[model samples]
Target: MRALRYLALAGLLATAGIAVAAPATYQLDPTHTMVLFSWNHFGFSNPSADLNNVQGTLVYDEKDPSKSSVDVTLPLSGLDTFVPKLDEHLKSADFLDATKYPNITFKSTKVSAAGKGKLKVTGDLTVHGVTKPVTLDVTVNKVGDHPMLKVPAVGFDATATLKRSDFGVGAYVPNVSDEIKVRITTEGHAEKK
Candidate 1:
């Protein structure tokens, strides 16, 4: 009986240790993260834009994916569509009105395993002073030590689609394409807890 108790205690301790190491919080590495958006330009061609600034905190639970969470902030001022004139126009009052609504944010409400190495993240997205629910399909590319940064890191590829009219961003809807497809590739470094 004594030996069995000792063994059980050891097993409990080991499980606790594993749980402690399983969950890690990573700070978004802005330099390694990119958010790109694409929309059909009058059904002639798809024009894409890039959002340069992004910062967020991601709590990843490898063992239990349901425990994972994320909160992200994106600045509207980082809009860059390659075309200088169009970029300026996007930031003006006619479109995004970056001066009025300078920031976009997302807070995860639920995180669940979609499939092998994939996560379905449902969250609230706030943009242009409007908040709406958004769902993202995220695939984990890799989760381990980063060679360049020499730190624990996680890389992910995620995609989401949002309607411009839903967020009050209906500038040239239907013509410029109301549906915006967003693609994000991010590599975040784990922060020391």
Candidate 2:
């Protein structure tokens, strides 16, 4: 009886260990995820646009953050500049050419901890049919059960700067500013097991 009890205890401990080390998968909440981009417009003003309805999945490993990964899709149809004419122009052949490349995507190649609650995520960003490696500075906003939904959730904010010329979107170059600043905020909910 003593030997049997010891074996059972060992099995239970091993099971607990595996559970703690496993990564959790979260589906990004479209309503809570948004991407914002800004750039200098003709040196006259800084204009910004917002893209919504983002879809993505995040596999987060709390024990080993390096094992985590991210994949997201941003639809150009959701892009809004607030001004109707400007929005149309941006989507036309002169700029993004939305009809040809309707969606932008990012797939993480590596994830590393930067500091406490921060990370350096390097990924491939595809824009205008060109793919470029980009690194984003990410801050973990929260990682726990959401108050409103009462479900396991994670939130993060990330920022990056990229040159439009690199992605074949350099229509105005120095005039409209080749560099673009991008900010992303996302909340993801874990599917109930």
Query: Which prediction has the highest lDDT against the true structure?
Result: 2
Off by over 4 Å in 2: 1-18
Q: Write the per-residue lDDT of candidate 2 for residues 1-193, one digit (tens) a residue.
A: 9999999999999888564557889999999988999999888999999988798999988768899999999999988999989999999989889999999999999999999999999999999999999999999998999888888999999999999899999998898999999999999999875
TM-score of 1: 0.89
lDDT of 1 by residue, 37-142 (tens): 9999888999898887798999999878889999999998788898999899888888788899998899999999998999999999998899999999999999
C-alpha RMSD by candidate, in order? 2.7, 2.7
| Window of ten residues with lowest summed lDDT in model 1 | 14-23
Clashing pairs in 1: none
TM agreement with the true structure for every prediction:
0.89, 0.91
TM-score of 2: 0.91
